[model samples]
Target: MNEDSTPQSSTEPARPSSGWDRELLEKLLLEALVEQRKARRWSLAFRVFLVAAIGLGFILAFKPLAQGGLTAPSKAHTAVVDVIGTIAEGGEIDADTIIEGLREAAEAKGVKGIVLRMNTPGGSPVQSAYVYDEIRRIKKEHPALPIYAVVSDLCASGGYYIASATDRIFVNPASIVGSIGVIMNGFGFVGTLEKLGVERRVMTAGDHKAILDPFGPVDPAEKQHVQQLLNAVHQQFIAAVKAGRGDRLKDRPEIFSGLVWTGAEGIELGLVDAVGELHQVAETVIGAKEIVNYSHRETLLDRVIRQLGTSVETALTKLATSSPRL
Candidate 1:
């Protein structure tokens, strides 16, 4: 080696033997952490899948028991179709579902009679009319199969409208059983908006399109037009009640004045045929002690969704204008 050229020192530090082992341990720990995360995710997914599967199985198991037409009881039985909520489209007590249950009960084997188990505060007039017409049709088709309305807590307005179509209306003495009229209600926020210095702007294709706007002043012409519409619907309601009840209903003006009445009062007014419970009616009236439910069963999720939708709709209706209801 030349005297002037000294040996060059290593620029890099000499790595310790433990450094490689430390890196390997760190890599292994990271891999273990990744595996743990993946495992936890899979476990959560499995739990969710298991819950969903159990729910599906539960629904499948109960569907046949709820809907009884396909597999009705062998012995004599009275079929019960529930009308136990607001009568509106897409509701638990909608016309389509009720009609389906009615048809099923009529077609079921060894069905002595069919009963409309009513407990509702009323809802859509159109929904009520659909059920009423269907009941009449079913009565015509199965004249021998006596159909009755058995009132529970309440059967008012649209509920009464449907009950009128039945062969007889039975109720407990304290049961509320009448409200044979139509109603349309809304708010008038014009004054409030004006006071608040807020202006409402609306665009409509026709002059009368916004006649029912909550933020608009009520025009006399529009009010009269709305009154005429209400009167027309009211007349239709009256006609249906007359046709169904015939001479059964008393000639009382208040009977059709949107007034609610107790079961006892309803009986006196010729609105209810008798005061009785479900079992009593089934045993004594239909003479079929064995009762089978034929109502559509809504799952918990379905009921939750439906109730949420109804709450939203009700809120919206309150904010805006409501259509005529019975």
Candidate 2:
């Protein structure tokens, strides 16, 4: 047989890969890589946000510690104690808080004098009385360290009661100084309930237990009893003012009433000693303008507000980065 005629075996052409194979594989790989990158970025961003939030929280938490130093003052400085907001039993300006500040100031070395920065509309008579008594006790214990109350926007009612116990009260000329009276306020909704056909159902063990309940009928005897109670409290309030004011108070019948007065008028009526602000009082009276606050840590309200701001920032960052850009 001729070499050429032996005839070579026919071999089939190699089949091209399936149309979907290369394209689909590349598409899937690209999609996976992109998704992985996005996931990584999101995770990094979330971690950053978390870290920033934590840092902010720490800053706010320790800010108060950085501001206050009871025993660390090596030089003469005016110790400040803030009595802001309502002076209630459970409030920040309560007896325990103020007393704590006063004690620290009493003990702090190089402290020439203490200043009570009061800005309150007043609350809780019992709380005020406690603070007043504590002040007198502190004065007796540390007669050298005088406490001066410096009033802000308002120092009325219980606020004034607390200030009265101090050696002197300094206030801004426009500051509201006094509301030397007690009041037990309530609302009577019986007429409204009757008009709306809303039946009132309330029970009490004692006859006079719910005397001030708005749903009940008015009792003349209860009213008289309440009035007498108010009168007794008023008398005590008057006595306290008289004792605190001593000869400084002028003979003014309306001074002990519930009427508020400006700082200027308060000075004229002997309710306030002089027109001055916190720093001014510190520089002039304490002879040390550098202030050192002895109050408690930063307020809960400040923390809440800061937390809310951080949350908003984190949310906005996530929203901006959640989607893919072109």
The best candidate by lDDT is: 1
Model 1 scores what on Cα lDDT? 0.86
Worst 10 residues of 1 by lDDT: 317-326
Clashing pairs in 2: none
Give per-model CA RMSD. Answer: 11.2, 10.5
User: Candidate 2 — what's its lDDT?
Assistant: 0.85
Model 2: per-residue Cα lDDT over 1-326, one tens digit each: 78888976779687999979989988888888789878877777777778677767876786555654234476999999899998877665688888888888888888889899999998988888888888889889888888999998999999999899999999999999889998998889989999999988887899899998888778999999999999998888788878877889889988988999999999999998998898988998889988888886446655765676777677667756775443
Worst 10 residues of 2 by lDDT: 63-72
lDDT of each: 0.86, 0.85
Q: In TM-score terms, which candidate is top?
A: 1
